[model samples]
Structures are given as structure tokens and as C-alpha cells.
Target: MEKNLRLRKNEDYKKVYSRGFRFYNKDFNGLCLDSKNNGPRVGFTITKKYGKANMRNRTRRRLKEIVRLNRDILPNLDIIIVPKKHTYTMDFNSLNDSYLNLIYFMNKRYKRK
Candidate 1:
């Protein structure tokens, strides 16, 4: 993902976590807030509880790839993804499905606001 398309600053992540609405499945939790930006921007967090640095990095990479491929599904939002222990073991297709399901739920919830 490009620099502009990522929520890179500590303040940015803090703002999203503090103000965004949240959603989750068995393996991941997502927080999203509306943004004035023309496109969606994303951030990822995987705690030490998940594993060592390499394992966390791998999970982050997987999440980033899923977002990159499905960017069009969400726009004008800032999102943060926090993966659970199971996320490290889930297959790509299952992970993608979980993500899409969360997005769909988010969309529905947003529309009601």
C-alpha cells in the first residue's frame, strides 16, 4: 500500500481507535471512522500475544494485501485492523471472507446512522 493510503501516524491510529465504530469476527476486529480523504486509508495492529515479530509481520502483510485488493469496497474512511490469534492460522480465502463480511456489516450499520 502507498504511504498516502495508510494511517501511519500515532495520532491517526489513536483517533480511529477512539472515535471509530467497531466490528469483529472470530479472527479480526475492525474500527472505522469517516474521513474527508478521497480514498480509504488503513492501519494494522497485531499484539505480542499473537506471536513473535515475524509472525506478527506475516499477519500484517496478509491483512494489507486483503485491503489492497478490496480497496474499492470502502472509500473515504480510516480503518484499523486488529487481528486475533486465530488470524495467524486462517487461510487466505477464509480471512478474505471474514473481512468482506465485516465490511458489509459496517456498510449496513453506517447507512443507519
Candidate 2:
């Protein structure tokens, strides 16, 4: 999971949280995004509330894959994916769609504001 393409560093996380605009969908416990111009970066967070170590790791892996796959469609925006308690039971396709859905939501949110 740590070696995943979309995973970000500590400093990157801080920058994204500090500088990026955000909007999330309810189905996504995780985030997907492209790095911004030295402004914000993509990021992810999985709390203990998600599950045990394996489950958390799985969620991270799923997010990384989905983000990596959709890299082209995303913008240079910072994204932070947080997992829900039930995230463990979700299938990969659902998890994948969650990222797209959230990004869609964010794009719409940005368009409005």
C-alpha cells in the first residue's frame, strides 16, 4: 500500500489540507486527486474507525489504484480520502466508483462556488 502511485507524503498532506479546495461524496471514505502546483497535493487518511490493520491497508490500496487509474481525468487539486467504518466490506468496483463520484461532486461544488 505504501508503494502505491497515488500515495502522498506528510508535507504533501499538510499542503493539501492547508491550500486545496474540497468537496466529498457520501460513498467515499477515501480521496482521489492530482497534485497541485506546489500549492496542494493528493493525500489520504484512514482512521482506526475503518477497521483493523489489514482492512485499513486494503482501503489505502484500493484508493491508490483507483486514483492511479483515473489520474488523467483529475485536476491538480489536493484530495484527502477518509474511510468509513463499513469501507472494509465494500468491493473494489464500488470503492473505485466512490472516488469518481467524489471527484464529480467536487467538480460540481467548485463550479458552483
Q: For residues 29-91, what per-residue lDDT tens digits would candidate 2 score against the true structure?
A: 434344545433446788777678898887777777777778766655566877677767889
Cα TM-score per model = 0.91, 0.73
Strongest candidate by TM-score:
1
Whole-model lDDT per candidate: 0.84, 0.64
Residue 19, model 1: Cα distance from true site in angstroms = 1.2
Clashes of 1: 0
Cα lDDT tens digits for candidate 1, 8-112: 899988899898888887777889998758788889988888899999998889888998899888757888888888788889999999988887777777642
Q: Residue-pair clashes per candidate, as listed?
A: 0, 3
Root mean square deviation (Cα) for candidate 1 = 1.5
Compared with the true structure, model 2 gives a TM-score of 0.73
